[model samples]
Target: MATVTYAFLCSGVGLALCERLLSQDTERLRLCLACRNMHRAQAARSALLAAHPTAQVDLLQMDTSSIFSVIRAAQEVRLRYDRLDYLYLNAGIMPNPQFDMKAFFKGLFSSNVITMFATAEGILTQRDGVTPDGLGEIFATNLFGHFLLVRELEPMLCHAGRTSQLIWTSSSNAQRSAFSLEDIQHQTGTQPYSSSKYASDLLSLALNTHYNPQGLYSSVICPGFVMTNLTYSILPSFPAFLWTLLMPLFWLIRMFTNTFTLTPFNGAEALFWLFKQKPESLDPYAKYHSLTSGLGNNYTQPRKMDIDLGTSESLYEKLLQLESEVRRKVEEKKKEAQHAHRHLAGSVSS
Candidate 1:
């Protein structure tokens, strides 16, 4: 049997998926946890090894918000593995979240109450910043960095005969209104998180169109309302006890909509389900959702996304152009650093 290698860019749901995969079969499976924090990654690896002592779990230090970090990590992956079966783009951020209490209260009495609770659609917005790469922090961390990583790992992913999968952990909050083609990086938006996620949805479709022929398949999944690090940040002021107190209300809300897959394990349902499926057999146009019923049953469901081929293609071209520009900038910066180092060395010698 061939060894299947899985690389994950998330911690919570990704770890849940890792546990599921190991539980299913530890033999001939290589799992790599690519994370920004080495300490946390090491802890996750230790925990996984504790559960399944014989499992192959490796860690790669990667900050998806940084361009050079992603490139270097991709290079390391190429050095370590000849074949990568799955790449999970699950790292994301929602910085400085500002909850609209008025809207939340109004929605409670309105017909959109379920939608508000299910998606957090009109109730939340975020303040975004720029990364050192001159890209929006949320955009870089959530979408572009993953895009660059995939581009770098194209050789391993698009290999002949065998098929590989690109599974993106998108969101139900990914609104079509939030994303703007003109401002792809979402520079002028308070909802950068939504825009970034929406971009991922579009990019997945575009990737499918381009890479499917090369035995590479791409799909998007919504891990609806999972209480991960990202969710915790939304209401940073709320204590853990307060959140615990709201459990009953949350459960009551879940009775109305199955989108409240609150736990990380439950949220990973769709991602884990996709793993057992044949890449070619999946629908490229649909966004798979992780759903948990009121009776606590977890299942995967596919929902048609509000996306068009023309827009997806356009986004693809824009990303290609942006990638080229970013690459050129990186090269120029490298040369400048080299010149600075040489100048300092000459001064010391003199």
Candidate 2:
């Protein structure tokens, strides 16, 4: 409807946006959703059409763990849109997630310790020594994959007459102490998930530094806590039927902190705000924390948190280098693929 190109990455919470946008009087926005799986994307599409039958929306396959996938995804985006209005990088994971029940029970007795260590906000653990692109699993999927997408799509981003923004889906549980430059990959006994989110924070900050001058802006937001596939990973392996027993309490807590495992809808608050705000108008160095005290009402607010600007800047430089190297590799591979095709064609002609 609107010419605004909104790429809702992972769009797990896109239903709300679709409803709100479709209700608007103007048909001035078109959507491109980047998702890891096709089925989920199609289901989302079906739901959207049920409400807004004429919505111009398409889906593209993207697995952030794969550099090649990011490249291909960007290529697809470039093919469709000459200018991008907003990019909400809402896709994230806590692979192999495990909760420390001791910590959870302890927090339960205290004031809604919203960011307690053992909640759905648990750090990441990947399958040992595996990545779609052969990089650190967490780093590759959670950070580098999005990083490469922005790089490859820079042209669509920096179009002369349009406003563009980049959004990073961050979390309130992020701690400065959890991240270390020496162990950026989190391979040295640190929580890989935390380090990766920290990297997302840094990358968003870095993006403002590098590209804002060229008319692009980036900001990061933390969705307080949400109950999604990513959260169920930490729900103790109790019988599913038995856990359904907690539904009443879950809804009660969702009233207090909104992290009680009903659903992750509140987590999209920061994301929703950034969607409507100017990127340069936000603090790149801040962790835009989302707070939801759902006390019979959903209250979503953003407050700045402590961050290291020095580390954020340094990480930016490293990412630039990585982006450059990846581009080189992609170029080399393109040449090889082209050459192989030409040789095969020559043999057939002979």
Residue runs of model 1 more than 4 Å from their true location after superposition: none
lDDT (10s digit) by residue, model 1, range 1-350: 87789999857999999999999999988999999999999999998999999999999999999999999999999999989999999998889899998998999899998898878888999888989888999999999999999999999999888899999999999999999999999898788998999999999999999999999999999988888887888889989999899788889989989999999999999999999999999988899999999999999999999898888999999999999999999999999999999999999999
Off by over 4 Å in 2: 110-114, 117-129, 254-262, 332-350
RMSD of 1: 1.0
**Top model number, lDDT:** 1
Q: Candidate 2: worst 10 consecutive residues by lDDT?
A: 117-126
Best by TM-score: 1
